[model samples]
Every structure is written in C-alpha cells, then in structure tokens.
Target: MSEAPALPPVRRVGQRSTLAYGFGAAAYGVKDFGFSTFLLLFYNQVLGLPAAQVGFAIMCALILDAFIDPLIGFLSDNTRSRWGRRHPWMYAAALPIAAGWLLLWNPPELSQDAMLVWVFATSVLVRTAISAYEVPSQALTPELSADYDERTRLTAYRYLFGWAGGMVTLFVTYTWLMAGPDGQPDQLNRANYAGFALFGAAAMLLAIFTSAIGTHGEIKRLPRPEIVTKPLGTHFRELWATIRNRAFLILMLAGLCYYSAQGISFALATYLYVHVWQFDTAAFGTLALSLFLGVSGAFVIAPRVANRVGKPVAAMVFMFSAAALLATPYALRLAGLFPAPGDRVMLPLLLTLFAFNTGCGVSATMLGASMMADVVEDSEAKTGRRSEGVFFSGAFFIQKCCSGLGIFAASLILHFAGFPKGAKPGTVGVEAIDRLTLYFILAYLALGWAAALIYRFFPFGRDEHAARVAALAKGEAG
Candidate 1:
C-alpha cells in the first residue's frame, strides 16, 4: 500500500463541531432513555402485554447483547477498508438501527402470543443494530484526538447533547403523549408510541448526518489489519486476551455495577411519581427537567473538579454523596415527613433531592469515562497495539448487560411488590410499596458504592496519563 499522506492540522473541536458531535451522540441517549422510560409502560399498559413476558423478552435481548457488542467491536477494529476503521460501519449501521427501533415500537397486528414473539425478535434486532453504531461511535472519541483533556472535553459535549435529547424526549411525552384523562388513576389514557416511533427515526437520521458531515477532516485513517490470513478463532482469542487484562476487567466490573443502578433507578421513577409522590403523569416532566439542568451543570464542571481533587477521589465523593441524597426520600417517606403522593408540596423536595443526586452522579460518570481513556493507554503500553475499540467494547458489553439485567430485575421486583400491570397506587398492597422503596435504596446505595470503591485500586492517575502521553509521542517521533 502507498504511504498515507501527512494528516491535516488537528482542529480544536469548537462549539459548532462539539454541537454536531453532541447531536450525533444524542441518538444513543434518546434510544435508551426513551425506551427505558416508556417502553415498559407501552408494552404493559398500552399494548396490554403481561409483565412476565416483557421481562422474558428483555432478558433474551440482553443475553444476545453480551455476544453481539463484543463481536461488532472486534470486527470494526480488524476491518480492511478505505472508508476508514469506524465510520464505514457507523454510517452503514444507521438505517438498520432506525428501522429496527421503529419495529420494536410497532409490533405486527397479531395475537398476543404472536405479539410477544414479534416484540422479542424486534428487541434483539434493535439492540444489535444499536450496539453496532454505539460501539464504533464511542471509539471515535479517543481516536479523534489522543489528548486526554480534549477527550474529556469531547465526552462532556457529547453528554450535554445527550441530556438535551433526553429533555426533548421528556417534553414530548409529558406535554402530549402521556397526558392522562382527567386527573386520577382508572381515568388514565396515554399512548407514547407515536412520539417514540417518529423520534427514533428522526434521531437516527440526524445522528448519521452530524457525524458524517462534521468530523470527517479530523479522524486519522488507521490501517486495517489483514483478515483473510487470520481465522475466526484468532479474533476470539485476541478478544479474550483483551478481556483478561486487569485494567479492562476492573473497568468492565465498575461499568456493570454503575449502569445497573442507573437503569433500575430510571425504571423505578414511574412508580415513584405515581405511588410515592402521587403526582399526575405530567408532573414528572418538571422533575426530568431538573435532571437535565443538574446533570448538564455537573458535566460542565466535572473535568475541572476531577483535575483539582484527582479523578478517583472526585468520583468517590460524588457517588457517595448521590447515594446519600437519594436515600433521603425513602427516609422522609418513613418519617411521615413527606406529603401524601401527588401533594404539590412534595414536588419541590423531590426535585431538589433528585437534582442533587443526578448532578453528583453525572460528575462521577464523566470521571469514569475519562479514566477509561487512560486505561486504553495503559493497555497499549502492555501490548504495543492500540486496541481502544476492543477494550471499549468489552467495557460496553458489561454496561449494556448490566442495564438489561437491571431492567429485568426491576420488573420481577415490581411483580413481587404487587405492581400489577396498570395497577393503581391504592390497589397495590402497602407491603409491596414498602418492599420496593427499600429495594430502590439498596440498589442505589449498596451496589453503587461497591462500584465506586473498585476504582480506588486503579493504578493510572493524572500524572501517569501525562507521562504515558509523552512517552507515546516520543515513540512516534522516533
């Protein structure tokens, strides 16, 4: 092959480029947040699907996720093509993702059993398609610039756009789709399918356009590995080696625990609003807005805070604080201090605690993502090959698997707690409420703290990253 040309000067990802990337990445957040928040409700209530079936379908999807995520990442890493390593796959996968997503929301007009089959099949398709896009898309962040700080900036920007997309999702559901008839249960009538179906398609298209148009000039065209000589077993063994790395293992475990908690917390919010707070469906929108503001503010400041206190310490502080703040609601509910569900007075307190919890949580999240980038450098030092995609795929595999299980677990908990499909608050036994509230606290506090503490043993700190970067730069020059 001919020698590659000298690359163009690295462009600082200014506001325009950042917004563009954010818009591209927002598809990732919208897909998850919209589906997590509404999909369960849509299936159980709107479509009259049973809780057990939904749980089974989601579990199947997750099990499939464990395999597909890593395979897609590994394939992209070794792909031999001129269009470049990730974007070729990234661009090609867009249509399938959109189509599969839309299919998930609209099952065939058939019997309930047939509907379940349709749902399960579409769930797998959409999840796989999305994994293809996201695994490669995330790889772009580190590949775009090797500078650690620039990577941080790009992640921050991407997350902010994610928050913005989530806000759009929230507004559409609250302002229109999820509007209840009258003001009480039994009078409820809302179906979010229209908004979700349309938005899913539109978001995917915007994602492709933003990424294809914006950063084309910046990414280096990495030489693809020769695949014809290497067999399938070679790829799987290499993937195993990547997973066996101590740093990668630690990151994967941490991502699993962290995202599991996040997924459950989000899934439980509907019950919290309907049962614990007694607010109308629309009121949750206000609470979601608080999340948007709080998390966005934290993303803006997380890097500076991490720089000051060190990433590990900052992560520990924020995560612990969030767990504590989140627990306050359960405590208040026990103390008889909170107003009855749906009391206007309770919204302010709920908003405040949730905002604080989400803000602190997002700060830790930014640090964790940045820390993973450092782990990539450590891996290259050990193996002498840049395998960010492989490592990141393993990391994402854990994250998605945990998230899927978390949602599945939440369903089982709700079932045991007597949160019957479309069951109203009073209809559900008090014992069930007591059980679920306790479970929420434990998932957030206990599981979350364990995930954070695992990071304390991580060896790569800020100074180490600086040193590693310098060494790599020197090696390149030589």
Candidate 2:
C-alpha cells in the first residue's frame, strides 16, 4: 500500500463545530427518554402485557442490539468515502431510526405472545439504528481535539444537550401529550402515547440530520486511517489488541456499573413518582425543569472540576456524592424523617435535592467520557492504530447493558416487592411501596459506589495523556 497522507496537528475545535457535535447527542437523548420513561408503562399498563414480559422483551432487545455496535464501529473506522469515515453511517441511520421508533410505539393489536415479539423486534431495530449513528459520532471527539481539558469541555456540551433534549421532551409529554383528561393522572391513556411517538420520531430525525450536515465541514481537517487489506480474523485480532488497554478496561467496567444504575433509576422513575411520591402532572413538568437545571449546571461543573482535580479524581468524588444524594430522600422517607408524600414542602424539597444529585451524577458521566477519549492517544502511542470507533463502541456496549441488566433488575425488584399493576397513585399498599423504596435504595447505592470506586484503579491522568500525545506526534513527524 502507498504511504498514508499526513494530517494537520490537532487544534482547538471551533465553537460552531463543537456545538454541532453536541447537538447530535439530542437524538440519543430522545430515544433514551422514550425507552426509560414510557416503554414499560406503555406495554404493561396500557397494552396489557405483564410487567415481567415487558421488561424481559426490552432487555432481550437491548442485548441483541448491543452486539451490532462493535461491527458498526469497526466498519466506520476503516470506511473510505468522499463524505468521510463517519458521515455516511450517520446519514444512513437517520430515516431507519425514525421509522423504527415510530413502529415501536404503534404496535398492532395482537396476542400476548405476538405482542412480546413486536416489542422485541422493534426495540432491536431502533437500538441497532441508533448504534449505526452514535458510535461513529462519538468517535469524533478524539479526532476533533487532543487537549485533555478540551475533551472534557466537549463532553460537557454533549451531555448538556443530551440531557436537555430528554428533559424538554419530558416537559412536553407531561404538560400536553400525556395530560389526563380533566386533570386525571391518565399517563396510562393510550392516545397520549401516540402523540409522544410522533413527536419523538420527528425530533430524532431532525437532530440526526442536522448534526451530520453541521459537522460535514470537519472531514478535511480530521485524520484519515490507512485502508488495510487483511484477513477478517486478523482484523479482529488487531481490534482486540487496540481495545485491551488497562485504562479502557477499567473505564468500561465503571461504565457498566454506572449506566446500569442509571438504567434502573430511569426505568423506575415513573412508577416511583406516580405510585410512591404520588406526583401529579404539574409536578412531573416541574421535575423536568429541575432535571434540566441540573444537567445544565453539569456543563459548567464538570469541566471546572476536571481542570482542578483531574478527571479521574473528580469523577470519583462526584459519583460517590451523587449516589449518596440520590438515595437520601428515599432512605429518609422510609425512616419517617422526611416530609410525607402530600406535604406542601415535599415537592420543592425533593426537586432541589434531585437537581443537585443530577448535577453531580452528570458531571461524573462527562468526565468519564473525556477519559475515554484520552485513551485513544494512549492506545495509539503503543499500538500504532487509532481505534476510536472500537473504544467508543465498547462504551456504547456498556450503555446498552445498562438498558438490559438494569431494566431487568428493576423488573425483579418490582416483582419481589409485589407491586400491583394498573393501581392508581395514592392507592397502593404501604407495604409494597416500602419494599420498592428499600430495594431501590439498596441496589442504587451498591452499583453507584461500585462504579465510583472502580475509577480509582484507572492508570493514568492528564500528564500521562499529554506525554502520549507528544509521543504520537513525534512518531508522525519521523
């Protein structure tokens, strides 16, 4: 093969490019909101499937879809095209993802077995389509800039927009689309979900295309990998070698635990609010605002914290703090120390603490993503290959497990707690609610703390990353 062309040195990405990159995450956010918040309820409460069946279908779908991420990542890494390595896959994914999302929400009337099949199939389609875009899109972070702090800043914007998109969708769903007739808590109403499906599909399509077009200008400036002709087995071996770094493995493990906790928290959010806390539609809208505030705060908090304490330490602190904050209200309520569900101060107090918890949690997530980007250069310095796609695909794989393992775990909690189906808020028995709260608190704390402690084992920091980048640059110049 001919010698590969040299690329320009990595510099600070422009504001416009950064914003466009961040905006792309809105698609993933929208998808996440739908899956975590409504999918279980929609199937179990509205469509009349059993909760175990619904949760199992979702878990199966996510697990099945996760296997596709690495393949998409590998293909994108070696793709040669006029539009570049990432854009073709990104553009190809838009329509299919939107179509699959629409289908997922609009399943036809069928038997219980057939309905389960529909859920599994549509869930897999949507998740796979999302991977086709998200893996390549996330890989761009390393290609766009090499500075440690800049990567954290870029990741902050990504998380900010991602969370904002979900929160905005949540606000709209509660305030208008899912509002019960005559102020009734009719989240179980079927018609409301139809509106949600349409809105989510349109938003996802727009975000994906906008991001692809917006970042198209960066193709010329980004590095292009040499197209290698090798046996398929040989390619897999190289991929394994590139992704087997100690830092990458630790980050992946940490993400597995962290995202699982997130999955469980998000999956059970509706049940907790509607049944345990007895929040009304108006309160749900307010909750959205609070979450949005927290994620926005994270955009500022993560970068500053990373700059001061280094990404690994900052991530550990925030993760441990977030876990404690998140579980406090549940623990206090169970112990009869916090405000009762109907007290005037309950909503305001809970929302305040939730906002703080979200800020810290999201800060930790942003720092972790930045840390993954740093691993790209560290791997490249040792292996002579840039495997952004492989590494980010590993990250996405862990995220999918969050949906699978986490949601499945949530279903078990519900089953073991004996949570009744189709029960209205404020009507569930005290024993069931107590069991639910206790199980959630225990599981959440265990997973969150485990993820945070795993970060302490990661091998390098800012200085090591800088040294790796310098070494790679020297190799290129030679």
> Best TM-score goes to which candidate?
2
Q: What CA RMSD would candidate 1 show? A: 3.0
Q: Write the per-residue lDDT of candidate 2 for residues 211-256, one digit (tens) a residue.
A: 8998988887777877779999999898888878989999999998
| Candidate 1 runs further than 4 Å off | 1-12, 181-191, 220-231, 342-344, 425-427, 476-478
Name the regions of candidate 2 deviating beyond 4 angstroms.
1-8, 476-478
Per-candidate Cα RMSD to the true structure, in Å, reads 3.0, 2.0
lDDT of 1 by residue, 1-478 (tens): 4533222112355676666666777777777775666666667766788876776777777777777887888778776565667777778888988888888876767788888788778878877887787787777666665666777777787777776677777766665565656643322343357556877678777876687667654444333333446677876776676667786677667677777888777777677667776766566568768888887778777878877878778777877777788888887787677666657677887888888888888777777777776776676666555676777677667766766676677787777777667776567777778888877877777778887787566666778777776676566421
Candidate 2 positional error at 256, Å: 0.7
TM-score of model number 1: 0.91
Give candidate 1's error at residue 157 in angstroms: 1.2
Give per-model TM-scores: 0.91, 0.97
Clashes of each: 5, 0
